[model samples]
Target: MTELTERIERLAIQDGTIITAYHALSFVRSSDVSEPVPAVYKPSLCVIAQGAKQVLLGPESYFYDPGSYLVASVHLPITGQVIDASPEKPYLSLQLQFEMDQILDIIQQPYFTENTGHKSHRALVIGQMSNSLHEAILRLIRLLDTPEDLPALAPYAVREILYRMLQTEQGNTIRNFALLGSRAQRIVPVIEQINREYTEPMRVDNLAKAAGMSTSSFFSCFKEVTAMTPLQYQKRLRLTEARRLLLATMSDATSVAYQVGYESATQFNREYARLFGQPPIRDVRRFLGMNPQ
Candidate 1:
């Protein structure tokens, strides 16, 4: 942990998330506990170098610290908060986003063999931080100090980290996310479509057709992989986007609500408060430290 912590601390010189030269990689540092931030997580490997955090996927709560890492193989709406941090020792973490094609390419390698009998599960998984994985992450972060080395060597380092992940206990679960014709694999398209079209009205039957499953089977399997129904999934996405818009710009709640596919400002205000523990305007203000709710 010393090596990982030292490297991340040196690179993360600020108190917010930073996207590095490696396009798929990002680093986070926060000096204090953060508000429960709502967002959609991409398919990525997330490692905490110091402190602890909690990630909410639907109703489930996942706690991880330096000893464990979290992986989200499918894009899903999640609420995350830094549960443990202080001015003396801030929360430090890294995220490496990967695409489905990359996972498929790796699985097709001759050295890799498919695990036929491994059953599929939810997209969000908590995995042990193996020694090799920790070392790989440290090496990846060390590249930040050398700008020239990044263009030539960063890909290899990133690929090595992915290889290490493939050898971990959660490898099969990650592999199943991209494996063709698998139940979870079949649902990937639906998830992507929901993310792309969250602002549009969605019909479950249409989504079921996209996944090539009947409505009942699609509904069941969707919940099995995402832990939320189709409508619930869309609502999460909408609310998360609304929160983002509110923070990023000066958009008011009603306009942001309409932009995120809400038909009624009354319903939007009601659900936003329920999910965020405050009204949209107050939540944003509390997050920005301008006002305390």
Candidate 2:
């Protein structure tokens, strides 16, 4: 294994995720391939030091490994799975989360050029990893050993990593999401609104007006970035939350369905089964059987 991979595996130690002293950074280790797990991914850079993984955004599948990096510029509900891993060489990776303010700060630097066009782009992107970017990430990871230096030096190292990322080919797309008044930026608030009020009845006209776009334009741009319509996005959010509630509490399928804003138990069952490949109760039972708490 490469030194980078070895260092991560040593630090990870366990099979799940480890939040480092640098709160924005986290390491993940998995010893075997996994089923597709759904969750809302925040804005972050994901790099794999060993093995590979797949991220499903709507119907699209994104695979990345040591040679490449994946960036989620916005919060997105996605299904992720470790596709290549084993106990001997586990899937080891790190995620560095950042805010739009950080990207905006970098864009203001004289060396950085702001793209003027307002075309909407996919929120999730994969780019070829450069040597400089890799080195920057390594430096950041090494900071875990020197906790004293981390308080001061971690920011610089993280900044360098972002700087190197912005120099890549997909950098322009990343910048567009953070650019002021851009369509992608405008759509962000709508996404946030959907996330905040997903249980409420959605009106396309109101959302379009809030975004300052026409109905057709809003629909096009929203789907362009999220790969799903606004209604579909809300449904996914609802079902995802329903699953979480069912697993974490004593609520039955019917109760959980209503809790997540489903008006009809029958409709909820049909939709939940379609997404999870089994009825709610059966799926929950299977999950609990596999991972007993």
For model 2, the local distance difference test gives: 0.90
Q: Please give, for residues 1-293, the per-residue lDDT of candidate 1 as tens digits.
A: 88777777787898999898788899899999987888889999999989999999998999999999999999989999999999899999999998878888888899986544344579998888889998888788888888789989988888888878877878899988888999999999999989999889999999999999999999999998999999999999999889889999969899999999999999999999999898999988988888655
> How well does each candidate superpose onto the true structure, as a TM-score?
0.95, 0.94
The best candidate in terms of lDDT: 2
* Candidate 2 local lDDT, 166-263, one digit each (tens): 88777888888888899999998899899899988899989999999999999999999999999988999999999999889958989888888999
Candidate 1 at residue 120, lDDT?
A: 53
| Candidate 2 residue pairs in backbone clash | none
Clash count, candidate 2: 0
State each model's C-alpha RMSD to the native: 1.8, 2.6
Candidate 2 C-alpha error for residue 177, in Å: 0.2
